[model samples]
Target: MKWFFKIVVLSILLQSFQCTDTDDNSGAIISAQLETKKQEIQNYINSFSCSESVGCGFIAFGSKPCGGPRSYLLFSNSVDLTKLQAMVKTYNDMDELYNVQTNAVSDCMFVAPPTEVKCMNGICTIIK
Candidate 1:
């Protein structure tokens, strides 16, 4: 009888733990968010025109348009404005500043302490 009670108690404890919601530790949710961000940046880069010398940069795009023509600050380093302008002209892309703003940051890190960015369509706005 004692062994039966012990088993029952252990089962109940296990069930309770299984039902608990620990979103902070959810790997799938985090992975999906990361993937979505990656797609947004990829699309933005693909559409942007920078000469072969300009290389690439990271950005946070929003899910919707950000009003009319405006300058965007990218989270990237070693960005050449001249090259970016050249690419924009070649690709007819919008004018956006990369790593030029005072509050610039990168979204390329996948390590602990995830980054939060608001991206819509091909426009990205950093949320610091």
Candidate 2:
């Protein structure tokens, strides 16, 4: 009887550990996906030509036209405008940012944790 109890306890413990591992992996995947999306957004902003002179950035998520013209959403720790511009060069196919943003707004409806950039119709908000 004691042996049976020990076996059951060990099984429960193993199952619990497995569940925790799965959760950790899932969290990592989600974070990675978000970061990739954020970088893509930054690329779109950098590609555009802001008229006049200004020091501002934008992030957009979701499918609504709520935020200003140039707005974006990020899921990372920092919101460095210069870093965002530099990151845009890493992508081989920048056009994909449109489809990705569209899907993110219409399908995933993901929002950046820090900024208020919303995506709508495959275009992130752009401000002058």
Q: How does candidate 1 score on lDDT?
A: 0.41
| Cα lDDT of model 2 by residue, 85-111, tens digit | 455433312323433444433333334
Candidate 1: how large is its RMSD?
15.6
lDDT, residue 16, model 2: 82
Clashes of each: 15, 21
Q: What's the residue-level lDDT of 126 in candidate 2? A: 36
Local accuracy of candidate 1 as per-residue lDDT tens digits, 1-128: 99999999999999888866655543222334534544554454556544334433443232112222222335323345465444434221221222222233444433222144444344444455
For model 1, the superposed segments whose C-alpha errors exceed 4 Å read: 1-28, 52-128
Local lDDT at 85 for model 1: 43
Local lDDT at 24 for model 1: 52
Q: State the weakest 10-residue window (summed lDDT) of model 1.
A: 92-101
TM-score of each prediction:
0.23, 0.24
